[model samples]
Target: MPTPDLLTGELTLTGRITTASNATFLGTIGELVVVYKPRAGESPLWDFPSGTLAHREAAAYKVSEVFGWNIVPHTWLRDGPLGEGMVQAWQEEDPSQNPVDLVPAEAVPGSDWKQVLRGQGEDGQMVALVHEDSAALRRMAVFDVVVNNADRKGNHILAMTEGHRHGVDHGLTFHHEHKLRTVLWGWIGDALNADELEGIDRVREGLQGQLGQQLADLLSAEEVEALALRCDRLRSDGQFPAPSGQAPAVPWPLF
Candidate 1:
């Protein structure tokens, strides 16, 4: 989920992110990455697939609960200067190094909540000073596969200095297709770890009980099925199962 800048109370766009799918800006309401929704008079025109976007993002939060991972921040649908938008709690980092900058564990210089772990990324990819030891990064990798995230770019995973790896930009997830793109390629083809397996087990057990009912409110029938399928596969595999999709690999420009 993208957040509104805090400094401005609302995100006021000073510039445009022409290259993005949603209307993006270089402005600051508080933390950076203020995503402005396309207003009625805007160039892109406001025909936002709001229902789908919100559904997916909210579902991310819901399914994350299955693993006991904090996949969601404070997100609410609100109107900003741009129009209807989703306001998210902001994570700290400079977006300038987005897409391919690496935050070595040493780069984080203060007391913070996230930690930077060395993860595999493509060559020439930009890296940022993600807050360093991600508490649930490995868990996040598993989540990405289940959701089939198509935009797991470098910027999406924020590693705070103290080690909480936060996964963001979940708008492109749950397409009912297998298009998993991301910067956490370091774990490609790797098997699930013991803790990760435990998390999956927890989710699997919960799916038939409380978590499934909770997800019913947040996800579509298909989405819920997909979630169940992913969980089932993990339980059966006892490992990070192989990529079962038709694509050669995950897409480019993870963000």
Candidate 2:
């Protein structure tokens, strides 16, 4: 069988992801599965301008690509059955491993995982949120920081086979003001690894070339400049940053 042409192949809506604030559809391009977020289906958000979420999603994919990290699955803007939207290749996550998990506080394991924080569950039981201490997740955390991702919920981190991690739902990103919220705060203040710092450097360089030109089509001038500033700041710090803005540190419904 030939590879499915995601752009031109017919899109069949498989299901609706109703939990999403905006209308999200599970779609298929021949045998290839994908998630489609149409611009027309997007709900209004006070912080972000309306009808631009799809472009933001595509911009996140471009950033991930420039960093040479397959953090976000292959995504692009296209005219789909629903309308013009961002379509991303679907990632079937490994059920056994989760990048972020909430375990009983007392039961938190000592090895392989880093404890993020402790909190009470709805049942009034103590729970400790933890994330795998691996290079994949650290890369994703860096990606989020650069994008200023404001809604990095736990479930958005997809643990794929062979330890690959993919981040999704990046519509709320690249705002001029600080708006970084995420569950991947376990590495705060940690020294940036050589590879991570190199990725940041590559992105900074790309911002002056094709990456910057492409982003100019998707984001505002101020937003693009802010992205460059984030890259500079992260490079200068040489470490994972602590939450600085007044915005909430994590998104609600921790997953």
Tell me, by TM-score, which candidate is best. 2
Cα lDDT for residue 49, candidate 1: 38
lDDT at residue 68 of model 1 (Cα atoms)? 74
Model 1, 91-150: lDDT tens per residue?
A: 675444332345544454444323323444566443343422233666777888777676
Model 2 residue 213 distance off true place after TM-score fit, in angstroms: 0.6
Residue-wise lDDT of candidate 2 within 1-255, one digit each (tens)? Answer: 124466678889999998988999999888889999999999999999999999999999999998998899999888888799999999999999877899999999778888988999989999999988889989999999999999999999998888889999999999999999989898888999999999999999999999999999999999999999999999999999988867778888787
| Superposed model 1: Cα runs more than 4 Å off | 1-19, 24-51, 78-84, 94-135
TM-score to true structure, per model: 0.65, 0.96
Model 1 worst lDDT run, 10 consecutive residues:
39-48
